[model samples]
Target chain A: MSGGLAVVGASRRVRAAHYATERPRRPVAALLARRGELAQYDGPRFGEAVFVTLQAIDLTCIRGERMIFSGLTFSVAPGRALLVRGPNGVGKTSLLRLLAGLNAPAVGQVRWAGGSLAGRVSYVGHLDAIKAALTLRENLAFWLAYRGHNRSLAAALDALGIAHLIDMPTRYLSAGQRRRAALAKLLLVDAPVWLLDEPVSSLDGRGIEVFMVALRRHLAEGGVAVLSTHQELAIDEAETLTLGRNP
Target chain B: MMRSLWALLHHDLRISLRQGNASTSVVVFFVLAVTLFPLGVGPEPQVLARIASGVVWAAALLAAMISLDRLFQADFEDGVLEQLCLAPTPLPAAVLAKALAHWLLTGLPLTLIAPVLAMALQMEGAGVVPLILGLALGTPVLSLVGAIGAGLTIGIRRGSVLLSLLVLPLFLPILIFGVGAVEAAINGLSARPHLLILGAMLLAAIVLAPLATAAALRANTE
Candidate 1:
């Protein structure tokens, strides 16, 4: 938790530039993935999210009898984002799931700092996972409690600009509001590697704006993001991985 | 870890209670199914007493089965199971919390209400204590074992039908010992052996079911 809090009222450029200058980057990112997967792997392992890198080395995804994707290679360094792009049924979601460790790669490895993906990734797939019966506050607070985060619940809500909807039940929320709430969880969760499958799928203009703000904030803090989105993201420096185009 | 598990347990109970009330449906099915026994067997007190233990045990097993398919289905569909598996607490411990919550929500209440149902069936007073005690010990095994079935069938379509086929056969030992305990007590014989076996089954389930269910979940999730 070293100076990990987002700088309040600081410009994004100053925040990103100042944070980099304030703390010298260490090669610890090379082993941040393995540190959490120690000899005893089950406990909550909160690694420093800065300077970490996610690597997928020659990964192959086999669903049933078909090889969905193969010989795929990529690495997302800290403070950067990987945009996974492909046509329908082109394995964007499959690749993300493999990286998230939801499905095992038939070959190669999806590693963080060259170690197992355990406890290092926070993944959000299409379903949102929000309880219909619970209020937005209850839903986010549950994830906070699950991660054992001591931060105030309102902090992340305010970041996503959904603080007013905190007490409202999620069942009453529209599809985009639920998606925003799902993105808000990315802030509450302290993981370095975030795997989001089609994150901006149903977000409106305002929801997309706040999401971009939060995503950049996450990147500025030296966290890594691997997201697959149908809409083109406005991130200038982010790398793109086009699946199925590989011969 | 325990705190997170407790949070999950409380979260599950709260959601279940506020929504469609899974446990209530299970209990209602349990009560109605038990009530059918006396009606089918006529109003003869001796006959009802003779069959009450078996009748109640059978109905409890079916009621518990009714709740089993839902144990993981909603969470799996909504993708909550993925987050749950990735949570800081080990998956097996998380499975244990869910299984305990299931028992507490569905099994424990079923146990408490069994005595009243037993009285309606004219179960002998001497057998009543053993009946309640057996249910208290036995119903957890139902929830735990049923969790394994639920986990294995998570993504399968119409899983409830397949869940019953997989779980009912395994439920026989618990049903046998549970009914045997009460029937033995009614027969003026020692129910200790039957009760002890049921307790041992419970201990075994507590240790094994979580690991099995976690593995099933992993296989299904992949």
Candidate 2:
């Protein structure tokens, strides 16, 4: 077990090093020039940050016969988390779907980086969407391949602690294990923002801690996340939006 | 874009293979229905030869329908359909890849087996070539057009029957031309016109069906 852990840790460091060098190097001269003044500014300039500044204004959603929610609004900026809190029927998932562009808002728009949200936004819905017949490795491979990259599959599985179940078919997985695999999907793509609906619903205590750790890393890297949860998240400085039942 | 489509196709084919039953059921249904026709109508060689093309084409059409709902239903229920929508590959192209995989599983198998079934039904030797040609061109259209009905009725319970009701009518032209090609061959006329028309419908379906299905999926999932 210690040997396996060392191998995983070693591979992760190698990949992280590869990412650092392969990525386009930022202008260090400008970084040093702006280092002193960086704290003076509240955030990136309006047009500078492409993935931040997501805003939802007066959004309304209605299902078959019920008005799930109405006149709801919020905003998510870079390095900030928007935690949506509400009761069971308060349309939390629906709102995430709206933001993810799976469903259009009945009344308003979602803006990203001061513009319309136009990129591939990652959404982890209630359903894990893993094929019950395929092994965990195959399931993750499908998403990674479909999204056109395999750079992070091993790392994602390692982070989620499902590296041991890589060869097992999803049908044999417990609910928590399956949820962990689903949460691993959030790391498979290079999505600018994550719309997570009940991201911790089926997770165990340790799974929840792992997810929060990964989410913090995502936010620290300037990605935005809109997560809905029934339990209180331990994320520091995350903004909260509470919704109530419709009239 | 091409990579994404390939990935979608690869994943769908893998699922179909692992599940093992969905595609097998389609083939089994096709074989059983084709075999049952002679029993119902009597095994007289003359009678069997007369209805061979119609029986085989009808059986293939029904077999295609039996599995059409499975194309999107599983993905939709499991939320993978939403992910597909959010994929960088435009939704229509993803739908096309899905339909292509479905045809490979259901349509291609039925086409390959049509000749054997035709032989059992005592179809003329010359008619066998046209039967295979007609089906190869026609069955894909069945999968494609069926995709529309599958998307539209995805949210409804027991939607397979509803899908048949909606799609069987659309299958009429393909069926008419598919069977007509074989009949023309048996009657000593050139089956080219019928085969060509079926090919044309396939071409048009190639362009339109995926687009329409993508729209329906967008609406229904929303």
Candidate 3:
């Protein structure tokens, strides 16, 4: 049984090598023959317009004695989303936090629209900022007021499909519902740049779909979103910026 | 900026009022502390009366300190502190607004209730008015100073004890003058100097403590 398993693994490795080498070299006619095989492969497209930019920046973060990430440089422009993919403990959230201006980068500068992304950005971290004591409507109202948005809270809640939960205290809401409320807060704000740290972490499949739809709307409206996610998001024309792997 | 400050203050006040337990607990603790003093030290009416002003002021300060940890713990846990820091309003203004709201909920009620507690402890009627007034002017300073401690210890695991240890020493002058003012009033002397000094301390803390607390918050976050 062990010998048979080893033989199968070796044959599979050989097949993978052959497929990797020959796939890119096939002509359009040959590719047409493998359309069914390629149908399942979905990834983001590159070379869209530039929305936001981070120059050759050195972000030296020290949580006691560890340097999280250093000399990280990347930029995402309009019509392009930077999907920060990295293993846990690779400072993915720390990078987003730095970009959001919540923590100052030890030695780097992150600029949006040719300037610091201070006032023109919205950040939603891993923790839900909702107050358990306040109803969803009250939480949204407080955030909107804090962001100086004079829009209709009812309309915002309606857009997120959270109008049903508007009067319920956020603590009683499910994880997906809490996430939706937080995303609603991001949408209600009028900022151009969105820094979302694992916005879909606790979301269900339906919740993920709702987020993708909202994100697509934001991208369509010329707003930019940067998020980190472990789950594959099959958004059309989205770009992935893998951190830690390159360095 | 002022609008943001006002909004934060209003929001915090509304939340505290709706919750109702934190402020009530602080007042209840204040009363318990005052009552314990008469019980523990013997209920000689003359002795209680002689020490009533100091007893009430010390109990009020201790009660205020007991609830200082709650001032920022809930907001910090709920991520509201991060939101406040990120708001377009200046950090100092936001911190000042939160501290002011805390004073309104905790300190203001203590001031209102201290007179009754003082009377029960056999305090002179004339001293009771000055006791309330002194607390009115002095407890805000305590709140502001205590906010600095709270901000400094925002994320520390064992922070409440450290916060009291850090703030109580700083609060001695306010307590001294606050109780001193009432004692003078009880003695039929003008308490104007002590009251004015306590007011000055309040004004100074109101101006300075927010800046210190904002800096402390920034340092802690960093």
Candidate 4:
């Protein structure tokens, strides 16, 4: 842990929601679902097998003439989460986008430690990716098919605690509700790595709790997630990375 | 696999269906634009017959162009395009799927309704068959090629005007061949060569436009 984390940790300790005991258990190793045929990107594509760990080594991101962040390094293991905390314009979102493979890093590579699961990253950014004209179920139905291997929407809906909004057109949902709908995608996707940018920004307390449960479920299932937010999520087994000018 | 492509196509169609008025209005614009010709130049059948193919083709071209501005822009704004790019499916395949959706929304309806509009403009007899065939083959190329423009202008402010400027020149080839085929049939000449060129254009657009559109989309997202 770096010095910034200590500062962040001290500040976070004052919050009443911190978990007193973090359950320590070994992370289970299993391939992401839709195995064999569909998960066709499992074998190592680089120097070594890196499927178990997600590592960002000397990563540099530049937007136009400005350097957002550079030489940023972090590695997250299976059944763990990395919380990205920083003030505004600190490249938190840029970092998550890089991890999602949405943008190529200016100088470094985001690699997995066990083996490369090339296409197994789920990214939920600021935009909800919902179709306001369509119902909630309709919006997610497409994702379910795109990811392949049909499963009941109930499980994903239950994960986000939005089962009642299933058939309603998403335009009817409030901002927080819409945010939960986007967060539900983490469950809908069977991918192991999640890159979420400010996922709880619009969520109320209950919505945040809903997100915590879903994220906990994801990490507990041997998945790794990188979440960028201004506030701490108080989830156990999650590491914090603070980006800044003087970190 | 093809499932992802199908899902993209399915999702687009569903969105269009829910926004029922948007898709239908393109066809309505096609109808109204074509109908305006007869009203403008009087009901002189000979004159209407002469310009009928050109007018209908032009209207279909404009209608396709208008609908295209929204094709990728909406998805790009909603973050669906970002999500699609992150998916396992290749970007070119996703572009192909979206182009197909665009064709189904604007091209197919325009093709189906064009003959009625052409006949309404006094374009009777042998010219009608060639017009229908030409449009069926040509309109898909319009959708495919329009995708390139849509992808290019996706993130820019007020990109539709720029989209029109970029695509109108590209659309000239399709218009010339499509209208030529119909005009040839009316003049008792073989329309085969023109329609063949249209088919070739469709095939070429199918191969090249997806790649181009995919590149544009990737660039715009960056």
What local distance difference test score does each model get? 0.82, 0.82, 0.75, 0.82
Number of residue pairs clashing in candidate 4, backbone atoms closer than 3 angstroms, sequence gap of 3 or more or interchain: 9
Error of 1 at A167 (Å): 1.2
Model 2: residues with Cα > 4 Å off, grouped in runs: A1-41, A44-47
| lDDT tens digits, residue span A95-159, model 2 | 89999888887777776644556544888898888889899988888888888766677799899
lDDT by residue for model 3 over A1-247, one digit each (tens)? 0010100000111111211231132243234235552232222221111213332244565556777766666555454466778788777788788887778877777755344566666778877888887788778887777777687877767777788888997779998898889888877887667788999988887778878887877765556678888989987646666656323
Query: Once model 1 is optimally superposed onto the true structure by TM-score, how far is the C-alpha of residue B9 displaced, in angstroms?
Result: 0.3
| TM-scores, all models, native as reference | 0.89, 0.88, 0.85, 0.87
State the DockQ of every prediction: 0.74, 0.64, 0.27, 0.72
State the lDDT of candidate 3 residue by residue for B161-222, as single tens digits: 99989999998998899888998888899888999999989889989999999988877765
Top candidate on DockQ is 1
TM-score (C-alpha, index-matched) for candidate 2: 0.88
Of models 2 and 3, which has the larger TM-score? 2
Candidate 3 residue runs with Cα over 4 Å from true position = A1-56, A245-247
Q: If you score just chain A, what TM-score does every candidate get?
A: 0.79, 0.79, 0.74, 0.78
Q: Residue-wise lDDT of candidate 2 within B1-222, one digit each (tens)?
A: 788788888889988998788778999999999989888999999999999999999999999999998889999988888888887778899999999999999999999999999999999998999999999999999999999999999989999899999999999999999999999999999999999999999999999999999999999888
List model 1 lDDT by residue over A1-247, tens digit each.
Answer: 0111111111122123232332344455345456653332222234333233577777887888977877777666667788888788888888888898888889988766555667767898998999999999889888888777677779888987889999999999999889888888888887777899989888888888898998887877767788898897899548877766434
Q: Estimate, for each residue in B1-222, the C-alpha lDDT of model 1 and write its tens digit.
A: 878888889889888888868878989999999988777878899898888889989999999889888889989988899998887679999889899889998899899999999999988999888988899999999999999999999999998999999999999999999999998988899999999999999999999999999999999998
